[model samples]
Every structure is written in C-alpha cells, then in structure tokens.
Target: MKIEDWFQTLRSKAETIEEKWSDATEQERLQLADQLFYLRQVSDTVVDLWLQFEERLSIAIRRIKQMEGQLPVDDKHTQVAVTNETSDKDSSQSEVASAPLKKGKESTSELKEANPYDPVFRRGEGFYHLRMFQDAKKCFEELMQHAPDWESGRLYYAYSLLFCEEQEHAFREFRLLSRSASSPTVVASSFNAIGCILAEEQQWLEAAQAFKSSLEIKTDQEEARYNLALCYLKDGDAQEALDEIEKCLQKDEDDWESQMLWLRAAQLLQSMDESAELAPPSPIQLPTRDLDTDTLQEMASLYESVGNYHRAQICYHFLTERLPREGWAWHGLAWNTWLIAGTKRALTLMKKAISLAPDQDDFTFSYGWMQLFDGKIDEAVRAFRQMLEKNRENRLGQSGMISAYEKMGEYAAAKRMAKEFTEDQEPYVRSLGYFHLGRLAVVEENWRMAEQYFQRTLPHISQLREVPIYMQLCASKLGEQTSVKELLQPEL
Candidate 1:
C-alpha cells in the first residue's frame, strides 16, 4: 500500500477518535475506551512499519555510497530509485515524529487547562451544599473567568451570591444572563433568580415583572407564578395576585405551597374588603388621605397587623364584596371564620371562595378540608382523592383524604394512607394519624384502644389546653385512669 494511503487511514481514525471524545457520556466513554486501545495498537504498528522502512533505506544508501566509489558510473533508474528512497525516508520520519509530538503537546495542554478550573468548580459545588455561600462565591468567580458562558455554573454562582446576601451583584449577574445571546433556558432561569431576589428585597412590583417574564418563557414554573402572586399581594394588587396563583394552580393543581400562597393572598384581599365597612368614607376626600387603592388597601392590612383577625376579616369582607368577582374576600372569610369556628364553617366560606374563584386549587383544597372538618366524610374524600390524581405527591390532599377515610370508618384505607404519609420526616402529620386511629377506637366504645390513642396525643398536646381533658376521659373510660388534675400539672 502507498504511504499516502496509510497516512489517510491514520488521519480518519484520529478524526473518529476526536469526535467520540468530544461528546461522550459514561456508556459512550466505556465503549470508546476499547476503540482508543485499538487506535493505539494501530499507531504502534504504523510506527514500527515506518521505522523498518527507514532502516532498509539507510542500509541501501550506505551500500550505494560504497558502490559509487567502486564503479565509475551508476545506472540512471538505480540512481533515481536511491534518490526517491532517501527522500521518502526523510519525509516519513519527519511526519511520524511530528505526529506523536503534536498529540502529546495537545494532551498536555488540555490537561493543564482542565486542572486549573476543575478544582474551582468542585469546590463551588461542595461549598454550595454546605451552605457556605461566601466561600462558594470565590470558586464560582474563578469558574466564570474560565468558562463565562457555562450556564449551570453561572446559575449556581448567582444563587451563591444571593445566598450570601449580595443581592445587587446577584441581580446584575441575573440580568446579564437573561439578556445574553444563549440558550432560552438560561434566560428563563435568570428571570426566576431575579424574581426570587426581588421578592426577598420586598421590591414587589419589580419581582412581579421578573416572575411574569419567567412564566411567559416557561409557563409550567409553579414557583415563579406563586412568587408573582405574593408580589401582587405585597403591592396591594389582590386581584392580580389571585390571577397569578390560579395560573400556578393550573400548572400544578395540587401544589400545596402555591395553593397556600393563593389562599393567603385571597385572605388579604378579603381583609381589604372588610376594612371598607369598618370606617365610612367622608363626604369629601381628605387632602391627606391618598384614595389610591394602594393606600385604601392599607386599612385592612393595619387591622391584620394588630392581631385583630375579626376586624381584619370584617374589613376584607367589605372590600371584597364591592368587587364580588374577586375571590380574595371569600378566602379571607373562610380563613378567619375557620379560625373562629374550626373546620365546619371554614368549609362553607371556602365554598364561597371557590364560587368567586372556581379554578383556584388553594380554595378547593381548603373547601375540602372544611368538608372533612364538618364530617362530610365522603365529599371530602372525593375532593382530596381527585386532587391526588393530578399530583401524587400532594401532601395536604393525601392527608385530608386519609383523614376523611378515617372519619368514614374505612379504618383499613385510612391506615394504609397513614403509613404512607408518616414516611415523611416531620412526624406531626403521622402522629395525627395515630391520634385519629385512637379516636375511631373511642367512637366504637373500644375504651382500651381509645386510651392508647389518647396516650399518643400526650406527646403532641403542649399547645392544647383541652387535649388533656379528652385524654383523662379516655383513661377513665378504659379504667386505666389518670385524673384531669394529674394531666394538667404544669411542666417543670
């Protein structure tokens, strides 16, 4: 075969190896390891072949030199072949030697480049996990210098800065990333970071704008919408807040966090409504009193800030009714009324809330909870079960459904759900499940079993002034008694 053809084959193999290494996953890397070994073998074979050819050419040249001295003249074809042989040897040796040298130099350069920045990235990850934000920032700064367009790295760096309480710098970085001519995901993520930062700073209007930008780019982002709704609430734009939360609920219909945020925002709007009734407007607007909705909204907020849920609810109720289409007033009524009347009345108010804002997951969940509290066991069960169908991980819906099942005397179903729910690290919900089991035993006149459940409640009743009375009753019924006086003894 011609040396030129052999060189072309080597070049093709090198190019294939380069391509494989350029974008290799773990599985691909394992497969390419074998290919790499085969390439090395071929390279070694080519080197040996070239060396042998050079050796033969060198011997022939020496013999030619001796013969030229012995004979008067040489054959033309023979002289030409010797000259060609010498040229080929020189060319082949030069190419072969340069090929290995070039590869070694490239490998060394790549290793040096990687070594300088790899540790910085690794340190950044470690510090981030440990919540050492300031230390993480230094590493990320190094990484940015090495790979400025590294999207994931930049995002982590921005978060580190935010966590370190460097909001201004983080905002600048996020702004840069959002406007960069890069992947759309980077832009969306930057907006998300900006929204979070603005929310933390209580810059509600700017935060809402950032979250809106994020949601427009990626509509399924529940956190962004939830944060946006919170910003609207902060800015005294209850209607807008309600709308954003509903959008979030549409994306993740069972997200309790988003649901809670919406419910709370709705409650604020209701407070605004109630305050409108507390104090009548003067026949003429006061010069000092700003009549903008923002200032008007503050009246209900002031009542709430004073721990007066009654007045707050009253004010929110009035403000919300004026805009009957707005759901926040009804939500406020439900939340405040529930605080006053427990779960039963809360359910009715939540129904009103749902009527005003039919698509809100938060109101729906609260309504189901009210039904559960009202002992509308089957209806509560149905609502929560339906919610779980949309999001299997919905913690509140699952717990509410389980409680409904327990209330319905489906002890086996309730027990199954309780077991699943209790697997969470926070044991309060799981303990409540146990308490419910004990109560079920009591209703069936299983005094001994009731005593067991009542006993379980003892560990969780520090905040309850009446739970011990029930515990005493359970003990008395079971004839394994502790007195109310004994149960109520103050903790040392």
Candidate 2:
C-alpha cells in the first residue's frame, strides 16, 4: 500500500481498538488494552513513515526549484537535432533561411497544425525548468522515442544529460546536431554547448576556437560571446576579453553577467598594465571608524574583490553591526567570516541577522547556508523550508535545500529539489548541482562520472567566483586526472 494509505489503515485500526474497550468484561478489557497498545504502535510507525516521506518530498521540491533556475532561458534555441530531411518537411525551413523551402503544401500543413494557444512541446518543460535532469531526460527520451527526430525533444534530452554530467554523450549529440542542422541558431547553440564542454576540459585555446566558431554561426548569441571572452581572459589575453565584452555590451547593455565579465576583463587589463609599468606603489590610505556605511561596504567589497577575506570580514563586521538588519550586509559578513574563522562564527552572526530581520529571505537563506556548512543539516532544512514558504521563488532557499539534502546523504531528494527551485536553468545553479553530484560521485568512487560532472560544472566557475577557493580544492580530490585549467573557463 502507499504510505498515506497505510497510515490511514493504522489510524482506523487504532480507532477500532479504542471503540471496542467501552463494554468489555475484565478479561476482555485486558485483551482490548493489549490490542490498543499494538494499534498505537502501528499508528506511530505509520506516522513516522508519513513524516519521512513528507520531509523527502519537501526537500525534493526545494531542489527542483533550485535546478530549474539553472536552465538556460533561451528556450527558443533549445531544439532537438534532426536530419535535414525532417527540416525540409517542417515549417522551420522557412524560419531558417539555409533550409530550402518545400512547395506550398508543406507550409500549409505546418500552418494548419500550428495552434498559438497550444503548448504541444511542453510536456517535460516543468521537469526541465526544475532542473530535474533525470526526470526531464526520461520525458524527453520518451518523446523522441515516440516521435523520432523531434528536434526539441532531442535537444532537451541532450540538455538534461548535460546536467547528468554525461559529457561524452551530450557532446556527441551536439556534434550530430551541428552537423545536421540548417538553422544557424541550432548550429550556433550546438557549437556553444561543445565550446562549454571543451572549456570544462580546460582546453582554453580550443574552447576559444569553438566559441568563435559558434559566434561565426550566429554573431548575436550573447552567451557564446561572453564565454568566448572568458576564454580570452583565461589565456591572459585581457585586451581581447575586454574588446569582446565591450562589443557584447553594445548588443545588450543591461546584461549584468556580461558587465561583470567586462569588469573582470578590465581588472585583468589593469593588472597587466601595472605589471608592464614597473612603477612604485602608492602609500595606502587607512579608513577611520567614522567612515560612512556605504564607504565601509565599498571597502569591504574591494577587499573581497582582491580575495582578502580577513580585511573584508573586518569591514563587513563593522558595517553589519552598525546596520544590523541589512540582509545583504549580514550575508557578506557571514560568508567572509566563515572564510576567515570557521562556520561557527558565521552561524552565530547569521542567526543574529535572522533574528534582527526575521522576514528577510536573504538573511534566512544565509542562516540556512551557514547551518549546512556547519553540518547542521536538519537546521539548514528548516531554515530553507521556511524561506521557501515565505517566497517559493527564493533562489538561495532553493540552493540551500539542495545543499541540505546532499549533506543528509539523500541524493535522489537533492536532485529532485534542485530542479524544482532552479526553474530558469541559470548556469550557476547547474554548476552548483553538478558540483554537489560530482563530490557525491567521487565519494562513491565513481571517478569517471565524477570527472564528467566536474567538466559539466566548469562553465559555472565564474558564477562561483565568490565561492571559497578551498571548496574547489576539496572537489579536486576526485581520482580522475582531468586538467584543472579546463574547468575554470567562464561560461556566464
């Protein structure tokens, strides 16, 4: 029986046992008492089972949200690889200029089938949105099996496997996609995926070449542009990175990710310039305690920018103590303090922050994150669950749920929740999920799978720039011999 159904049966047994006690003889009463005790025990057991299932489902749901956030938003570009013959038969032929148009009948047939209100291709999109790769993979695989050569199904299946860290399989699929597609967008997206894979292997030069090829196929694809810039930066070509990012900004100004890349490129260029000049350094200007909170925060950020966690903490501590309810301040302070000290102090401060501003999702998330870091998995789950209840769309809450589930060694629950919360398929979320799965696989001595997960995770390094260097150090313990260089390529 299902867990809930079993629980109901036990509850009914307990009710019957209680009801039978009213008109019993002494011997019958004694018998009824024993029966009642057994029923109570059964009830407790069933209740425990229900709680366990509920907890697992809750954790799974949270992870699903987190994973969904990791998926790319360019759903328009997420197509399955199909033969040219298929394209010729479909209306995508007119949409993609390279495909030779069939006579009027094919176009008419496509138009007749096209229902603006219908979402025929959205069967597993919810799973895809949630970052439930295996579930999404299953859905897409079934779709392809049922409707062979459906481009969207094939693409989504490959995309799901990308999260599963099946690098070779995903890469092969993309290669086939690139070879067969008439659409420049499809070709560009395929090349981009391949470039990202190469980057995971730390083949920076090759990655750059692949990204360039993708851009050649479709110059307007911003992700490819940003990734190519990252490749340039990795190769110590700051000027190229800077120039490329500048051009990218021309196409989309509000792309904060590209802006951050531009910032990194600019910083690298400045470093290169400084190295060339051989000039004496200027004397440092120390700030007094009377400095404004904004200035202090700025100083802290600058220290953080340079990887100076100790100095950053000092600044954050001062700022957060003064502005106790500032959620971001508390978050900054907790992360830096965790690095400088250990998770203990970070936990304390995060708790204080949460108490000071009980409703702030960011502070709640930080507290949960610190708890997870401290190995307080149950506490982390509570904090994340509360955060999610407050706002189902909380990214940090979703990420924290994934972390908590992983810490508790519930891999299936973790994978399920990661997808549910990360609905957008942001690269960072994908990276984080892959990172956890990689670590888990390594622990299980599944080295090949670990290596593939790590490779899939490489494109997300830039998203994790703020993550402690030590986490990477720990993850690098996988027995696989993949180059670290390949895994640091920026995927934006």
For each candidate, give its TM-score against the true structure. Answer: 0.34, 0.40
For candidate 1, the TM-score is 0.34
Off by over 4 Å in 2: 1-282, 321-327, 419-425, 465-482, 489-492
Model 1, 1-492: lDDT tens digits are 997998798788778878888689989888888887888898767655654565466447546765777322432211211011111222111111111000000000011112346456555755655456687789889888987766556766886787676879988988998887255555666787787666666677887788889778867555566667777777778778777767766665544345445545555554444222222112211112223333334545554543456655665566565656778767876777786778755766677778878667677778787777777777777788777888897777877876787677787887677666546666666566566666667667787776776565555554333456667777777676676657654456
lDDT of 2 at 402: 72
lDDT of 2 at 120: 25
Q: Which stretches of candidate 1 lie over 4 Å from their true place?
A: 1-116, 274-492
Task: For candidate 2, report its TM-score.
Answer: 0.40
